[model samples]
Target: MKTKHYLTLADAEILMNRAVELSAQRSFNMSISIVDEAGALLLMKRMDGATPLTAHLSLEKAKCSAMSRRPSKFYEDIIRNGQMGFLTLESVTGMLEGGEPIMYEGQLIGAMGVSGAKAFEDAEIAQKAIHDFFQQIS
Candidate 1:
């Protein structure tokens, strides 16, 4: 058997908090979701004023990222590149943006997703959390 890194509850909480802080700092109410390597939710938060749908979208985004092992944007780009058929691939969703996998020491530990503002803005918040998360763990 081989050992692998994974996100602990403490790490998930830290990532969730950082994502929330970044959203608040930018004055954007957002829903943030964190998922383990298996795409199972570990934490989720919908900030004040965020749209109701954002909560669900964020979770899907995190799951897609974790399961795909790539940023959601990667799939978006594929669809944009004339593979619109990518949408029908039921194995993934949340392909618009805002999904990011957490990597540490070359291992995929978990993933994060954010929603509420523009797609790029959502992705930015998730990226911030991923960065801060690594700092905390390192």
Candidate 2:
């Protein structure tokens, strides 16, 4: 049997903390979600001032990234490029942006998603948090 790398609760906490810090620094009160490789939610947070809908959206985005093994923005881009068929995908509900897959040593471990800011800003926050997470682990 082959060993598989997966994210633990501690890893999820690290990602959430980093995302929270970055969001605060940017004055963005958003919702954040961390999900395992299989698209199961590990942690979720909705900051003060963030809408309730953001909490749901963030989780969906994280699931999309985890299931697709790619940034959620990838689907968004495809849809923008006139690939309407992508919208029919039942597995991915969040396709706008802000979802980023977490990879370690080329292995997909989990994903992070953020919402409430602009789409690009959300994506940026997620990316930064993942980057910081990797920095800490490295």
Looking at model 1, how many pairs of residues clash?
0
Per residue, candidate 1 scores C-alpha lDDT tens digits across 1-138 of: 877988899989999988999899999999999999889999999999999989988988888899889999898788778876634545445776999999877888889989999989999999987888777767
What TM-scores do the predictions have? 0.92, 0.93
Task: Report lDDT (Cα) of residue 122, candidate 2.
Answer: 96
Q: Write the per-residue lDDT of candidate 2 for residues 1-138, one digit (tens) a residue.
A: 867888999989988999999999999999999999998999999999999989988998999899989999998888888867634554445887999999987889999989999999999999999998889998
Count: clashes, candidate 2: 0
The positional error of residue 124 in candidate 2, measured at the CA in angstroms, is 0.6
Per-candidate clashes come to 0, 0
lDDT of 2 at 36: 91
* Top model number, lDDT: 2
Q: Which portions of model 1 miss their true places by more than 4 Å?
A: 86-93
